[model samples]
Target: DQQVKQNSPSLSVQEGRISILNCDYTNSMFDYFLWYKKYPAEGPTFLISISSIKDKNEDGRFTVFLNKSAKHLSLHIVPSQPGDSAVYFCAAQFGGNFGNEKLTFGTGTRLTIIP
Candidate 1:
């Protein structure tokens, strides 16, 4: 079964602190991984991504680390801000068909950054 899992339903952090979100996948065929951030009433925006061949990827204040051996991945946000409060989804694309590589999303984790 293809299942991307986000264990924590929510996370709370004070502004300017670091925020870490974890995800797991059981499917070995997933070669592309992505993290998306969403605000209320808006679609998710791509944050960071990593291929199965790579172990880490970073963008500005966001970093994503993939541990293939452990079937796990994580997103780290540095100096978290109050504006960063939103839902985060971990998604993966599997199979050779890029067009058919449907995004399997986690249940989503709500991040709250306290001012």
Candidate 2:
């Protein structure tokens, strides 16, 4: 069964604006969450991550917010740039240490930054 979902298959954002990508999960057992960005013909690269204990995490232009009560999470990119365009994936892990956790990934969302 598909436990994670990204409802929006694609999103477009103007450069220099904020881009919000959303995801939802059906599995409440998941305790750790992560975001990855993939470029064409390249592997998905880790972006940001948040633990189940925290509501939000930020790094540079990227931020991830988790709403445990609703089983929802989002990635926010501020001042989006053309280089930020990519396919974004949201992942969850349950019951393991960070280094060894098995991650479940959502269907990716394609984000395009319009210049």
Candidate number achieving the greatest TM-score relative to the actual structure: 2
Give the alpha-carbon lDDT of every model. Answer: 0.94, 0.95
- Point out the worst 10-residue segment of candidate 2 by lDDT: 94-103
**lDDT value for model 2:** 0.95
Mind sharing the TM-score for model 2? 0.95
State in Å the error of residue 42, model 2: 0.6
lDDT of 2 by residue, 4-113 (tens): 99999999999999999999999888988999999999999999999999999999999999999999999999989999999999999896666658789999999999
TM-score of each: 0.94, 0.95
lDDT of 1 at 81: 93
User: Which 10 residues in a row give candidate 1 its minimum summed lDDT?
Assistant: 93-102
The regions of model 2 sitting more than 4 angstroms off are: 97-100
lDDT of 1 at 19: 100
lDDT of 1 by residue, 1-115 (tens): 5389999999999999999999999988898999999999999998889999999999999999999999999999998999899999999998577585789999899999999
Give candidate 1's root-mean-square deviation (CA, Å): 1.3
